[model samples]
Each structure stands twice: as structure tokens, then as C-alpha cells.
Target: MSIPHEIENYIKLQPESKRNDMLELHERILQNLPSCKLWFLDGKNEQGKLVSNPNIGYGSYLMKYADGTTKEFYRIGISANTTGISVYIMGIDDKNHLPQMYGKRIGKATVTGYCIKFKALKDINRDVLEQAIKDGAKPRF
Candidate 1:
């Protein structure tokens, strides 16, 4: 249940070719969010069925839902997909902000409303990615 254990397990479960990239991204995120909180989601549903890729999260924020409910969640997240990796930037009010700001500069990554996904770290710009993570961690609402 420890954050390091969970992160190690998740990375070990990834394909051989993806492990190093995952590790580098992990370190990069940690460097960008020094002293921030860490989170690991095993991608399991209540029944323990796999629903998503394991996620390593950083920072903290209160997520408010439409029904006026709120819960604490990470501000940024990193995960490995079947094809590659995904960096999630949560809590932004404008859905278009990420794509507009990072889309053109991030190289091969796909910049969506809240996610920047790419086949590998070398396929994208590390500086841009770090900036996105830093921006995502700030409260924008």
C-alpha cells in the first residue's frame, strides 16, 4: 500500500521497452513537484477488476462534482497505456487550455482537455511536459 511499492509494482508490470521511460517520467514528475504528495491507484474497481492502467499521482486538490459533492484527488497523474504513456492535468477550468497551450510544442504527444499522451518520452518535449504539470498543479478555478 505504500506509494513507492505501488509505483514499483506498476512499472514492473509494464512492457520491458516501457520500463525505463516510465522511470524517467516518474523521476521528472517528482523533480517538478518536489515535496508534493504522492498517490498510486492500482486501476482496480471495488471488486478488484482491472478498469484502467495503474496511475501515479502528484499534488492534491478538492474535486467538486456537479451534484455539489467534493473529494480529494491528485492534481496531476501519470500512467502507462497499452501503446504508451499518459500525463493527466486535472482541475483546469478551461477544457481547451491544455491543448491550446501545449499542443503545438509538445512534439508527438496528443494534448487533450486534461491529458497529454505520447508513445514515448523521446517523442515529446520534456520542458513542455513539466510546464504542463506545474500549471496543472495550481488551483485554476
Candidate 2:
């Protein structure tokens, strides 16, 4: 039905460990983003083929394409993956920003340019992750 309902359903479908972790992360990201937009992508392409893990998104941004088209998208996203959970910080100009800034300090996680992935919340520096989300949440207008 609604985006929030869909997000709750997606999180509930995860395994016990992942379910708990996703719930915590969902709340944390909301707290950081405040009254931002919400999104639920059901991991399917237009043909309904599975293209990725279902993800919950927060906030909003304009994604500019090379051909001069712009699309509104989420500023931050989270999803449950096969091995762990992935957090996406979108609309970054540089691909090395996240890794270079928080790779070593953010605990046992893989800090890519636009994503920070970890097996569980306990495996990362909660404060560091929150800071990253906060930084990413700023409207890239």
C-alpha cells in the first residue's frame, strides 16, 4: 500500500538478525533526516525482474544525468543484502569521498564513495555512520 507500510513489510521479511538491524538503522536514518520524503523500491526493474535488494530511502535530491535530464531521488537509502546491510548516500560528486573520509574510522565496514556496508550495526561506529548520514542528508541544491 503506502511507502512506510511497504518498508515495514520489507524489513519484516528479513531474517531475525537482519530484521532487528534494519529496524534500528531505519529509525536512526529517519532521526537524522527529519521530515524528509520516504521511498520504497521493491528491487525490480520496469519488467518486474529483480534488479537489486528492496531498499528504503529518505530525503530528496535532484539527480542530474549526462544528457541534461534530472530525476528526483533519495538522499540516503538502506537495504538488506545477502551478507549484510547496505547504506547508500546518494548524489555525491566524488566517488572517493566516503571511503577516504571514514573508511578506517567507521569500524568493520566497507566505505565506498556512496555507500557504507556492514554485516550489522554493532560492526560499525554508530556515531561515525550517523555523522556521514547527516552530512549526506544536507540538500545538495
Candidate 3:
């Protein structure tokens, strides 16, 4: 699907009350990560176009690094009850690297395998998140 279509569809799914909040969050993300290529992912997996799981409900921006690699920058997503915003980094399977790089900034963030989930956007350090995104895009074996 086209970018605009994806954006519209994703927005349509949100309650009218949260539309403005979502847009503000979306714009903030774009402003923060200028080099990333954005894509709206079905975190909840209810779209039926891809996977269908309810544990995830969020939008993501897929950024491709200069090294020809890419990573996911999740803006905001809902999981049945809670809301989250996250950015994935290198060694998704390596816990040591994440904490070493992010430290306490990863508030309530739990990493399972390669997925990193933050409690909210405000809790994270944007600079660290940006570096993590760049690190995620770095060549990995």
C-alpha cells in the first residue's frame, strides 16, 4: 500500500478522540528521525493483511541505514490494554548491549529476542533511541 493510504488507514483505526494525539506523536517522531523511511505496521495484527495477533497494536517507521540495513522505529502501539512506543536496536537477542547503551532510559522496556517495548515516548532518551536505530541499521551477522 502507498504511504498516504497506510497513514490514512492507520489513523482511521484510532478513535476520533485520539486522532490529534496520534498525529502529534507521528510528527514528533518524523521530526526526531529524519533519515528513516516510515511505514505503518499493524502491531495488533488485526488488519488481517499480515499476521493476526492481538499482543501488538502500534505504528512503526522502518528506517534503512546508509549501510543498506534497516530497523523499526515504533511510534505508538496498543496491546490489548496498555500503550507503548519503542525503537529496536542491534543484537535484538543480546540484552547486554541494549542496557549498556540505554541504561535507565529504557524505562519499563522489556526486550524479548529483538523487540524492545518502551512504556511511553517520554520515558525514553531520544538521542539514545536515535543511536539505537542507527545501531540497528548497522550490518549484523
Candidate 4:
């Protein structure tokens, strides 16, 4: 797949030392996410070309329902700065019932429209996170 020119340029501009690390990180995210159609959006750049900030506006991974009869939902991206990775999941509504079902794994979650912002990945369980991504998505139709 061809990455957007901006993303390609951005990656090309990264320091050679950090390039491999970022590539692996990006690949890990893609691997962890369920197989689906991948799309890229131009992330905002307020603080220059550094990838450390939440510069990549919103990155979405689209997944289809099991029956393939429903709409495809988005797993929004959140940059985990301290951890040097991004976390993907469904938004606020998904996080609502998560605490009871996920307990301490959820830690704390903040809502923003249909999306939720959280701090650490360790705070949420992987199974819970994946389920949230699946449940958080809305029908495309």
C-alpha cells in the first residue's frame, strides 16, 4: 500500500537511528490489530516533524464485522508518548461498561466524542482492548 506523501515524507525525514524503532512500532500496531482495510489520514503538525507528539491527527484502522453484513467500524488511534507506541480502540461509549468488565485494567479513560483517550496500555487488558475496538465501531451503512 502506498503511504500518503506526507507520511512518506515524514518517515523519510526521521533520524536514521530512530527510523527502525518507529517502523517496528508501527508494524506492531498493524499486527496487533485484526486484519482489515487500513487507511491513513494526515496528522497535524504543530510542533514540527517530531513523531513524539500527537502529531498524527487521527489514525484509523477499519474492521468488518464477522457476519460481513454490518458496517465497518473504526479503531481510533491514541499516541502513548511515554510508552513510545499508539493505542487503538473504540471511543467513550465502549469504555463506559469497560470498567465493570475489565476492572483495574481500564485504569482511567476520558471521552472525546465517539472516542476515548487513555494513558497507559498496561492499564487495559489486551482482550478488553480488542473487544472495545470491535464493539466501539459503528455500522458504515
Evaluate model 4: give its TM-score. 0.41
lDDT of 2 by residue, 60-80 (tens): 899999999999989999989
Ranking by TM-score: 2, 1, 3, 4
Show where candidate 1 strays beyond 4 Å.
none
lDDT of each: 0.90, 0.91, 0.51, 0.46
Best by TM-score: 2
* Best model number under lDDT: 2
- In model 3, state the lDDT of residue 42: 52
Q: Candidate 2: misplaced stretches above 4 Å?
A: none
- TM-score for each prediction? 0.95, 0.97, 0.49, 0.41
Positional deviation of residue 103's Cα in model 2 after best superposition, in angstroms: 0.7
Candidate 3 on 34-89: residue-level lDDT in tens?
55555555544445564532222233445568899988654333232145433344
Better of 1 and 3 by lDDT: 1
Candidate RMSDs in Å, in order, are 1.1, 0.9, 7.1, 8.2
**Model 4, span 99-129: residue lDDT tens:** 4544445445543344445544444355655
Model 2: lDDT equals: 0.91
